[model samples]
Target: MKVFGICGYSGSGKTTLLEAMIALLTARGLKVSLIKHAHHGFDIDKPGKDSWRHREAGAGEIALITDKRWVLMHEARNEEPPQLVDILERLSPCDLVLLEGFKRAVHPKIEVHRPSLGKPPVWPEDCDIVAVASDQAIDCALPRLDLNDPEQVADFVLKHVGLK
Candidate 1:
């Protein structure tokens, strides 16, 4: 499957852009999957849920199933978090995979930037960043895209990945 990444500092609207891009991409008939990296500890299961109880009972992996969807939760315990390649291998076939984090990975990425955030851009230091999407125009060597325009951003992404 083709892989692309959207990366930026916290509060830079990375998720918002991804949400819009996904809708646009899927509307065009491409199958898309996503893998997001969380910097802090996070839990998707509730304390009183069966999955949570199973995990609390020392189950290393819990697979929760319903008519609508299924989710597999694996506890890291003493093991380190899985790398990008390892996770990619587990995903089913798809036209594209949009990564929400994993900025250090070598995959091509668009650096979502917001000048109001007061954070330095990541493109200068990261060769993997092929373009910059910002709320306000800034001087940069790579192509600059309007952060608020999802259609234009999606077009850039599809063309960059050869999906257009």
Candidate 2:
């Protein structure tokens, strides 16, 4: 599957852009899957959920299934975190995968940039960044796209990644 990623500082609107791209791509009949990389700790299962209970009972890996969707939760348990490729392989087949975070991975990516975030652009250090989605025009070697223009951004990504 074709894979592209979005990377930026916190509060740079990565999630919002991802959500918009997903909607636009899905509406165009393209099957799109998303893989999000989270720092700190995150929990999809709540305290009272069966999946949570299973994990609490020391289950290393739990697969929660329903008619429409399924979730696989694995406990790290002192093991090294899985690689980006390893995580990507587990996703269901789709025309393209939109990944958030994983900035260190060697995938083609668009950097979401906001001056208010008070962070430097990752593109200067990472040649893999092929585009920038920003709120304002910035002089850069890479293409600059509107952060709020999800449809156009999706088109650029699809063309750049050859998923079109």
Candidate 3:
């Protein structure tokens, strides 16, 4: 699958842009998958839940199955967080993969920026940033898109990734 990343500081609207792009991409009949990176410790299984109990009992992985969905949780234990490529290898094929995190990963990316956040764009520093979507004008030489218009950002992404 063609992979692209959406990266930005906290509350800079990365998720917002990604949501709109996902809707637009899906509407275009493109199958899209996403990989999001989280820095904090997280838990999908609740205390007293069956999966939680299994995990507490030393299961390395737990699969919770239901009519609507199935979730697999793998405990990393002493292992460090897996690399982006490792995670990508496990995903089923799709037309495109929209990555919401892994800012440090070297991949083609669209840097989402909200000038109101008072932060500089990631592009000039991160060469992998093929484009910038921002809430304000930037003097960047690379392609730039209005963050308010997701369709424009989506078009830029498709074109940058050669899917256009």
Candidate 4:
């Protein structure tokens, strides 16, 4: 799949921007897949759910399939977290995969920056960041998109990534 990344520090509105973009992207008839990276431990199952119980009971992988959706949860156990490329291999083909993390990966990316975050931009140190979306103007060789304007940002992303 053609891949793009949306990355930024915590509270920098990465998820919000991505959510907005996803709606616009899908409305345009493009099938999109996403892979988000979480630094801390997280669980999707409820405490009393059978799936939770099965996982707690040391099931290696669990597939919870229903009419509307299917979820496959794999327990890493003592194994290292799967690499991005490895996970990508398992995904069915799509028009694009907009990854929310894996900032260090070689794929092209857009860096979301809000100056109020008091954090420096990642593009300076990472060449893979092809553009920046921010609340205020700044001097940079790469393109700067308005973070508050998801439609414009979506347009820029599509153009920058050479996607229709």
> lDDT of each structure?
0.95, 0.92, 0.89, 0.91
Better of 2 and 4 by TM-score: 4
For each of the candidates, the C-alpha root-mean-square deviation to the true structure, in angstroms, is 0.8, 1.1, 1.0, 1.0
Model 4, position 71: C-alpha lDDT score: 90
Best by lDDT: 1
Write down the RMSD of candidate 1 (Cα, Å).
Answer: 0.8
Clashes of 1: 0
Per-residue CA lDDT of model 3 for 1-164, tens digit only, reads: 89999998999888988999999999999999999998888898799988899999999989888999888899998988889999899999998999997888999998888888888777889989888888888888988889899999889889878899
The 10-residue segment with the lowest total lDDT in model 2: 114-123
> Sorted on lDDT, highest at the top, how do the candidates line up?
1, 2, 4, 3
Give candidate 3's error at residue 86 in angstroms: 0.9
Give the per-residue lDDT digits (tens) of candidate 4, residues 1-164.
Answer: 78899999999998999999999999999888999999899989999899999999999999999999999999999999999999899999988888997888889999998888899889899999989999999877899999999999888778766785
* Range of the 10 consecutive residues with the lowest summed lDDT in candidate 4: 155-164
lDDT of 1 by residue, 22-107 (tens): 99999999999999999999999999888899899999999988999999999999999999999999999999999998999999
Which regions of candidate 1 are displaced past 4 Å?
none
Which candidate, 1 or 3, has the higher TM-score? 1
Q: Which pairs of residues collide in candidate 4?
A: none
